[model samples]
Target: MTNKKQRLASVDALRGFDMFWIIGGEALFAPLLALTGWSLFAFGHEQMQHSQWHGFRFYDLIFPLFIFLSGVTLGIANKSLQGLPLENRWPVYRKAIKRLLILIGLGIVYNHGWGSGIPADLSEIRYASVLARIGFAWFFAAMIVWHFGPRAQYAIAAAILLGYWLLQVGFGPLTPADSVNSWLDQCCLPGITYLNRPYDPEGLLSTLPSIVNALVGVFAGRWLRQKAGQHTNILVGLAAGGLACLLVGLLWHRVYPINKELWTGSFVLITSACSLLLLALFYLLVDRWQWRYFNYFFAVIGCNAILVYLGTSLVNWQYSSNSLFGGIAAALPDAAGTLVIACGVLLLQWLVLRWLYRREIFISP
Candidate 1:
């Protein structure tokens, strides 16, 4: 097996790659398109926006991809847990439970507004959030990985995807307001519902399918762990699996429709396919080829991902960026000015993360 520490650098880099787009990479596109008038930047700018109601976009993959990577980490980290006595794993459970609770609480805070002080009415809070979904999905998926064998885990994932499909068909239409997912959110979920009134995209029932997304990551992670050091074999396996998932997802979409908001089974499969392919590319370039120099930029962000994510929401990095680089940005042309601002914001965020990375103070959950 490869050195244990080295195995995770690519994973961190991939995660940073995903988060980069979310924080500011996508914003960079608009300015690029304006400056160069390049169709490529235009295409990227379009992909950056989330699709409305149905269908998919590159932006839609961001949240689920993060959840999926969490699972990948779970699988690799928990491999040794499988050999440990059940009682010996309590510390692990404690740590996971702590992480889950923190993510859920942070998710609520994320929804409620971080800097803008919480609303007076407790009912005003939107309890369901992106972080909460990650917490629930990762925690449950981790439980499964700890308890079940790979074959059983595979069976469980298939059952989850198929079962969620059946539930949607039996309960409600896929429409935003009428779907079972929306209904559950409106009725059972407390606080304010954002995105879709009466339905949060990261709401209740949709979380089920998300678990499968994380499980898919676990599957990929385990595969990578088992085939460590066999670069050719690992590459072929991930590519084949990703392609197979894409095919299955497309075929399923004919019936189910790939809806990210609903967290539909088809959506899970398709996103998981994308996640796998991305992971493969990151693995090949960063891990196999040892491309540390370029990968380090992302790895810094990945190391302190949760900090930067929550920090962006809570702290005003944009204000700081403007303070430091606004004059330089203002001197440039309109499009170039916007690009400079975006780069400044990203650079500020990266600097904080780089500081933590240098001090080895990586934070998560």
Candidate 2:
């Protein structure tokens, strides 16, 4: 429940770590495996990227974890709000709403465009997106946290996941390829269903479970903010929560199948657990151990994550890559454009974040 000034370094580090993957694939270990003649689309890499209709993968866990972390941060933010009088809550609420709106607007702008050569068909524009889902989930969860206490918020989150699971299993129709859940996505999302080409990673129906993920973090955040030794509390909470998630996810996987696209109850459990574990690990290493160097790089990127994503999407980094290291890569022979683009994007985002950080300007949602 610490204020912005008292925010934990571990949270920032974790946020930065999450953004590293999203900003570019190369910064992560995935590209290394791919470079070693392992096809990211073959075997596990494809699974890591996403499940086709059903099943789970390491990559599927990433987005939900981020949402969960956001929820945790919300709890912390809420605690900080306690010192402010009742009169000040209105302004905080306004700020939260504005952040959500800006995130949604950015999501739309990233998908659609205000410039020439924009696709004429409105329906073709990707409506459901990652930022949109996060914004919606964060806004709703924040409202719940703001109104009801943390206990109530947790109950609401659990209800959501369980309810979604029951609905998908008990009432949803069947599909020929997978199970009823996959079919449910198509049936529920219908017109907005991601049909291929350029698809929405965060679609409409999936947002339900995503909201729960964020709420879980909210609960964690509230717990962490309690008056106690930070390290012990974080470790215990993360361990317990993560273990519970892993166990529940594994058990539920049998019936529901841990499908990322469907955002099954099991998937939510598993990802939340992973997120908790990751936060614990980061907290232990960066905060507890007082490691400074590794964090600065990620903190920079984490601070301006949204801006970095938008910049990369709007402005091409290919020219920048070519201008800097293209010739060196070309001389090496058979360098994939994907690798080059990934590297360029990482460097560009890093530099931008570093610059912004130096100016004490943080673009947060």
Top candidate, metric TM-score: 1
- Which lDDT tens digits does candidate 1 get at residues 266-361? 899999999999999998888888897868999998887887688767887778888998899889898888888899889888888888899999
Clashes of 1: 0
TM-score of 2: 0.84
Tell me the spans in candidate 2 whose CA falls farther than 4 Å from its real position: 1-7, 27-48, 79-90, 113-121, 173-193, 196-201, 335-342
Worst 10 residues of 1 by lDDT: 111-120
lDDT to native, each model: 0.86, 0.71
Clashes of each: 0, 4
lDDT of 2 at 47: 49
Model 2: lDDT to the true structure? 0.71
Residue 206, model 2, lDDT: 62
Deviating ranges (above 4 Å) for candidate 1: 80-87, 113-119
Evaluated at residue 33, the lDDT of candidate 1 is 92
